[model samples]
Target: MSEGPLYPPPGAPTPEEPAAGPPAQPAHPAYPAPGTTPPPAGWAPYPGAAGGPRPGLALGAAHKPGAFALRPLGLGDMYDGAFRIIRFNPKATVGAAVLVTAAAMVLPLLVTAVLSFTVGLALDESGEIETSASTSEVLAFLAAYGSLLLSLVLAQIGITLVTGMIVHVTRAAAVGRRLSLGEAWAATRGNRWRLIGLVTFLYVAFVVVLVVYVLLWVLVVALADGPWPVVVWGLVSVPAYLALTCWMWVRVYYLAVPALMIESAGVFGAIGRGWVLTRRAFWRTFGIALLTVVIANVAGSMLGFPFSLVGQLATVFTPEYALLALVLTQAVVSVVQNAFTAPFTGAVASMQYLDLRMRKEAYDVELLREAGIISE
Candidate 1:
């Protein structure tokens, strides 16, 4: 060889080296460090992966595709995906929420106004301004309160119905599709009755719990020898009852709406499915549901705070129009808040439901197949 020696003396340039040339470059500088084995081709980090993804600057190579960015998400994926869906299909998702919110809000207010006017007329006619009010007056007051409660319940039902439509639209969006308002409504047609029935069941369950608690208090009042015993009984029973009620509600109905809407299950079937799916994942489901609600409430409160403050301030400066301003402010705030929150919440809940399906049934495989990422 034409080298100074077989190899140059320690650190000296060999015949293969170009003396005084530009610095040498690696063919693949991005390769793993010296003495380390490179990861297998196409390997990447994944949720619940074995030892996690190989350390590298490359993006996830093994993150299989789906309708959404990635299918079968982990907790964070589902949480983040909820908001993503909102952006993905705002018209169907947010528009539907806005429309439902408007109806749910305005109709209730109108009913309250008409009912209040009628009640006021009745009271004025009774001419009971002097002395104590009559039994009919007391009954009228109760009726007013009852109507208010009914309006609230109706509003809740409307929200729940809209939530079902939102889940429907989101599922379509997840499959690389969109739904028109009519299409979403049409999709929910088969499930509307089941949806109402499921909500009714939950309400009935809650009423039953309340009635049972009331009966227990009545018994305590009748049987207890002293006020101390009754007070003690109330103290012990109330918290326990409330805790049990909350736990039962979370476990039984966390997935009920999704099951009814997505799986097309019946009311009782949805309840049973929710119970089964939540059997081992109760806390996870509950945490997600609770987190969604808390976030929505916090966001809504933040958005409405300024408007509410304005309404309150206007009461002092413009007393004549304060009531109108407050009412309109509340309506506008509620509508805007619901528009954002309802769809986002529904999307989050539906993702949680999808997560359960993936964990329990490998639903991701089908999603991937539908997205053409896999065959058979």
Candidate 2:
């Protein structure tokens, strides 16, 4: 009946690990011989399981009494277990997403403003605009707007990196290690440029796909002079974009920042290393993220509902309230949407980071041993 701080609650433990400890050393009359089958459902020599020996020590658990047990949380197990995490560990998921989204909101505004002003200043002084209405002035406008656009894209990519770091922290935190935004930020300090390059590469690839799509649509429009071909093109394009969306996500999302933060991988090394880790685990990664997104969207809807109702009423009845209504809607969307959803994105990223590291490093097991959750 006791599920202490470390002891898993019901549904947490697998059926094998008894509520009580394992048998004593002398309780065993016989040990298995080499090259022979061990016990049914073989037990890994977990360092700190009940009746288990410490590190480098071996222990066996009996299953149906015939075959050796497989390792806990191997790839197949992790794939199956990911949803269990989303159901049980949602707090970690959102906590991670929010940190990243908040950074996106705060940092980009400052970055865009500063970069825009610098470009405007350059246009006045050196871009060779004879007057404010000149082409250089026009370029200045583009620069300012482009800065904003670039800022948004950059924020998205940075959030991905943040996702990786948060994942790293969550994995550690699950094992009773303390973690914080400051620690995650410190881990990201020098890695920003390489991460940016990775983001840029993926962005360019998407842009090229989009451009090709646009051209094909334009050609279709010119030739058919009817809407049906255009409609067909649009239909085909949806899955094209979906595939690419999943591509950049899987290839580069966890690769850059998580690899660096958790595995201490270098910039280029992180890319190759990430691919290696993610190649077969795409759906597991996607499922954990997809669940986070769904929960965040639901929570965001709950948060936004009130504001949306007020906004609708404001604009419908009050003609003079137009400006006020518009601003209010914007405020409502930001306050509600970001507040509820950002953290969820960060947390999902965080959990994914933990799963990756646990598979690669078994740090969780070591951590369990150190925390006395498992025996030495």
Candidate 3:
């Protein structure tokens, strides 16, 4: 009977394949009703043998086809790429950072100490301290502090230049080119002092803004010592201070360094450029910068902690030896810390700049063209 029914089974459809043709649909059926549509031929609920979502078509998204594509970067890319750039060319990225950092730090300290001692000795020998203790001592103190300030400014300038070098080197490496320290310097050659000037200008601008805010508060207090002063402080000073600080540091100047280094922008140009680049992407850029700073600090602490502990321990037993050891250890740790951290910061900045350009200006296209990956 079953063998005979095998031929008679054409009368009704099985559960696996529904019967075709139009029919009255069921209100509450266990299966899809008659005339119900099926997926088109060669189609699927999901693509591929593994039944995963279709490539490029799933979720209305497209895949990036290559590495180092000039595209809007993800937070992970911004982060991981920071270390990737360092890994790509450690000699250039880390070496340049270490050397420049050492110079920037040690030179200033040396100059400040030597000049202070010299000024103190000269004042002592001239007997100027005895007659006019106030005047001579003030002069000596001013000279020492002035020298210190000068050295600090010089050190900052060196750091600015080093930042430029790091950007150039990391950027080059990102696009598959390794650079030497000299080559990285050359990439930012004519713009070294310009970068420094841009940084200094920004610093001055921030200070000016702070001073203006302070003066406004002072003026408000001088005009009214009562509730009016309290009202102004609450309504104007506090909110304005917070808003302007966030706007300037986080939104305005966050990308200025990269703009100056990568685009050869002037001081004011860099500020404007950074403002433009950070538009509508404040949180992402802020997150990137914040994460970079945290990572850098953590890494620096990790590197320096051992040396610091050893130095402190040694000092309890042998002071003179510990002093020498501590100096050497700190210098070594500083170099190591900067070597890793500087490139990461530089890479983060460069990545942010590139991502901004890619989003705003199709900068990846230009980069690809420059790298000969694409035709004009």
TM-score of each: 0.71, 0.54, 0.65
Best by TM-score: 1
Name the top lDDT candidate: 1
Ranking according to lDDT, highest score first: 1, 3, 2
Q: What would the TM-score be for candidate 1 when compared with the true structure?
A: 0.71
Instruction: Evaluate residue 312 in candidate 1 and report its C-alpha lDDT on the 0 to 100 scale.
Output: 71
Return the candidate ranking by TM-score, descending. 1, 3, 2
232: Cα error in model 2, Å? 5.9
The alpha-carbon deviation from the true structure for residue 229 of candidate 2, after best TM-score superposition, in angstroms, is 6.1
**Over the stretch 67-117, how does candidate 3's per-residue lDDT look in tens digits?**
243468887877766665565456567777676656655643454345434
What lDDT would candidate 2 get against the real structure?
0.50
Cα lDDT of model 1 overall?
Answer: 0.63
On lDDT, the stronger of 1 and 3 is 1
RMSD of each: 17.1, 12.4, 20.5
Q: To one decimal, what is the Cα RMSD in angstroms of model 3 from the true structure?
A: 20.5
Candidate lDDT values, in order: 0.63, 0.50, 0.59
Please provide, for model 1 over 1-376, each residue's C-alpha lDDT reduced to its tens digit, 9 standing for 90 to 100. Answer: 1101011112223234324534222211144557745644322211111222223212342233322443556667776667656755566677876776666556445643554455441322222322455665466555544544564566667778888888776665454444556656656776787798888889889899899999989998999898999889978998999788868877887779988887667888888888888888877777778887898999989988898888777656754343344455666677778778888888888877777777788776655444344444
